[model samples]
Target: MPEPARDPRLKSLINQLQPGPVRKVKVIGFDGVDVLVQLMDAEGEEAEIGRIPLYEASMRRMDNPSELFELGQEISAEEIGRWREGQLHLSARACEIPALRSFLLSIERRQIVTGTVSEVHNFGVFVHLDGEPDGLCTGFIRVPDLTWTRMNHPSEVVAPGHRITAEVIIAETRSGQVTLSLKALREDPLIRFADQIGRVLTGPITKIIPFGVFVQLAPGVEGFLHLSELTDEPGETSDRLVDEGELITVRVAEVDLQRHRVRLCAADGEGGF
Candidate 1:
């Protein structure tokens, strides 16, 4: 069999190219987290190029880059100068474009989005938005958005790998952040508690702040008993009269639906309403 002649265009591209900042490379090889790519010239001709080190494959914590990128995957990258041995040191992470940012911004406020719980942090939950490109995680649900009721930790409402539906609360395109809220999908219990106004409700004191005692009338529904309403004592701390988890009788004095606040007074004690 006779050998076929090479394309003159491909030879010309290869001869004209020098390792500096190659773009639009295709993954031709992989080792651990490192990747070897076939660099494409301006004319889209492929030439043996360089490797992207594990550290340069992604911005996120990557145990194995191959898990995310596969052979023949086309990715843009920058060639960080050249090695003395005639190889290009590439950075694939730099190729992480703003596609996610633009997509998040295009998402309307209050738009429902489903995502898998990727991480549960002390302050919030990190969700990997569904339908988005893999490894593009920027969706966050703050602790307040995890549930309607008070939560000490995000894990109380969501665990890692839990699939959840949430509303887009804020889409910050500039910062490439999407804030989500699961609670927004539900009705506020405080609003429903309005009908309980002027009724005597017995519940446990959940918290005692300097300003008042929070009495849980129902799940996600709490009434504040201001320090002034707890006792007639001139200068007594709320802790002196109430303790968390202590059952108490209170008359719902007022329900401020607009502020999502409820005021309560002792039902029969010295501070009885």
Candidate 2:
């Protein structure tokens, strides 16, 4: 390919092609090694599609293989020569275009990827996913998924310039927007605890309210320890029976999968309710 200017037709999806990785594989060419790379989305996510043999493609594009600092970077001509010297000569083949076509055709817009968070906006985030594409990653972290009950600012859980791993739950190329979820990756607490219904376990007080005490049966999972179930005297502070991190054996009373709710009581399974 000539040192050409950007194509007006590809302006929509072409991220500046860059150097990729190298590894050991058993192909006739190369040192029995190969490289893997990803096509990234705006949120610094891996698009489901990308080059088949990223190393070879990258080497062919990059003139200076040693100068390629990271994956998803632009390539040069010298690197291509190195690949040829290593017995992987695409230029010598009669049908070079077919092999190269696979890499260019597999570009994708939906997939999970990891990146250093560049900035946090009121509604979303922006991460510099190398040089390929720098776009906004929008959506909320949901109330129940906050993980910290300290009434935090979005910056607290994930600071500006911090690296976060998120799932690509929503990716519509037509809009260039995406939604991520930390909770989706999590096992539904109710479902997990429900499996332990017949087993005795302990819960620790997480929060106290007029109606009940919220006790944690497991991390990111909670159960209602109602005041009525407490073996305490009338008017006694709910905190007395259940304080934060105070463990008490409890039997699983109910598991509501729809609501992701769990109800617990004394492990003896004798509560009248």
| Local accuracy by lDDT, each model | 0.75, 0.46
lDDT of 2 by residue, 125-199 (tens): 554332233233433334344332233355656767776665544332222334454554555545545576656
lDDT score of residue 80 within candidate 2:
22
Highest-TM-score candidate:
1
Clashing pairs in 1: none
lDDT of 1: 0.75
Poorest 10 consecutive residues by lDDT, candidate 1? 13-22
Q: Which candidate gets the maximum lDDT versus the true structure?
A: 1
lDDT of 2 at 71: 47
TM-score of candidate 1 versus the correct structure, residues matched by position: 0.61
Backbone clashes for every candidate come to 0, 16
